[model samples]
Target: MMRSPANKIPADGEPELPGVPHVHVASVVSALATLDAEKAGLDALAQAMAGPLGAAFDVAVATIHNSHGRVIVTGMGKSGHVARKIAATLASTGTPAHYVHPAEASHGDLGMITSDDVIVALSWSGETVELRDIVEYSRRFDVPLIAFTSNPESALASSASVVLNLPVAQEACPLGLAPTTSTVMQLALGDALAVALLQSRGFTALDFRQLHPGGKLGASLKFVRDVMRKGDAVPVVASGTNMGGALVEMSAKGLGCVGVVDGAGALVGIVTDGDLRRHMAHDLTTRTVDDIMTPAPRTVRPDQLASEALNILNSRKITALLVVDGTVPVGALHIHDLLLTGLA
Candidate 1:
């Protein structure tokens, strides 16, 4: 920790902190220091607020789980940003949540809220004029309300069903008038509530997959069939077929390989580009597909995860795998498909 210079007095006004060093190594160390400080502050705040925050969280989870509606978070200014992030986190983590700016809550947004919903209001001063209507509306409509405010006795806190006192010490800002520390404390408490409820509900990665079924995260959740090429797209030929016919089919499939199937069309053996190279000296035009096909093809089930398929492909150094249903090749998935879907 750097000590305050004796010449740097409060009466001398705000003292400027040193600029981060220009070199990459020095900049990394300074950035790490800031990260460490933020992490410590968040941990400390979480500990300091455990009792009240836990109680409030329990109340919120019980209210939402038992009720037929959602959770509405309302705040103003910097607290509003934290409230929005909290709402997003809660919703993504299995709890239904939404943020309603207090000012907007008065402009017909209150109508969106139902009695079944619980309102979590955040206000550092606990006396924002903009929040009065929604606060009063919650009271009048009998909707359960939980308030977060620095003042336990403020109008907003006093109007709620339960009040979580925010006892942040001082802002990181030298002026001590900004919302820095207070916002951090609120954000930490919000995360605690969200995570506690998340763990309590036994939320799973599969559950999260359902909520975010788009983009990279969604691709990571996909099954083998999601990226597999099905039907005629699969490179395959029946056993005992001539190598000339197999090469023709493999070339048509354009996947660099072919699966040799039996009468059931299920995969029995695989022939790859490497196999062709290995048999280059031999006249494949005279050999049967079974004579060249490597028996017992590597395969994956349609129900298996694509990530597992990727691991298999990487380990085997194969370009593609046959997706089988009880030895029947329903689809084929290439490594390029995984890369296209951002799962590679």
Candidate 2:
């Protein structure tokens, strides 16, 4: 028995047999072909969205947006997996949505959907046997039914109130049996619906933060006031204070900088390590803080997002930002603070 190239592992620096592709090379080719096929499918989807699908998509978005209840997303098999992700995206983006497996819908999950709720079903063929119960339930209750399918003539599409007819395209799978390009199209369409609804509702970043309060995204959306060190934690010196006193305040506060406040308690300048280095001289300690400070140093408003403050810190190449109310220094934020908050 002769070992084929696939069964025979090539040793280091050994050439592959003539007219035979290495396993890795064949895999790369397959991967590239899959990508190309998916890309083609996406192109077709984009074209459909611009053409016949536009009116139906708008109607679907409006139907979901105007609904007083949550969106019930349902599908079978690979489409079920995509439906779950779509539901999550919709929920996170301010639209109430949840997935119900078609198989489970027949087994008593049908009660999970209400008459007020809208049903968004995903089925490439639109004839999934498991989806029949959901379709019937939607029809019986007069619940709004939105269908995603390539076959507009299929049972699901014929019964749906809004049929988003997907463009039939070649599958990424070489055998053309697996749900590859079709699932991608469904997922992309689901995202489009979610985003359209989200925009229609005027959902803000603060709203998003409220929904996602425990992650890095939450930290990034936090207000500067929420992260800044307030009150006595901020290092400060009187406008006319000498560099020696300013240095003491900076060292005591450990923020590497001291804010110089005028008589009215408004921030006028900042004395940083860089300023001290630039003003280095025999009389440096005796110099007035004004002489060693940088006037109108970059500052962030307390109401600004921490992510914006991070941007300023990175662009200015500085480690600290003074949080201000008008010209009054109320707080200080260090790069370390942002890092601790997981914003960096």
TM-score on alpha carbons, each prediction: 0.82, 0.93
lDDT of 1: 0.83
Residue 48: error of model 1 in Å? 3.6
Tens digit of per-residue lDDT, candidate 2, span 1-344: 99986677655764444555665655666787899999999999999999999999999999999999999999999999999999999999999999999998899999999999999999999899999999999999999999999999999999999999999999999899999999999999999999999999999998999999877999999999999999899998999998888888999999999999999999999998898888899999898999888999899999999999999999989999888899999999999999999999
Error of 2 at 93 (Å): 1.0
Q: Which residue segments of model 2 deviate by more than 4 Å?
A: 1-23
Candidate 1, pairs of clashing residues: none
> Which prediction has the highest TM-score against the true structure?
2
Cα lDDT tens digits for candidate 1, 1-344: 56455333333333334673232344365556555655666776667566666676677667656667888998998999999999999999998999998888888889989998989999988998899999899989999888878888899988988788766566665476767767888888888778877888899887988998888888888999788998779887888989899889989999988998899677889888988888886577778888787888889999898889999999988888888899888889999999999988
Over 4 Å off, model 1: 1-33, 49-52, 166-169, 199-207
CA lDDT of 224 in candidate 2? 96
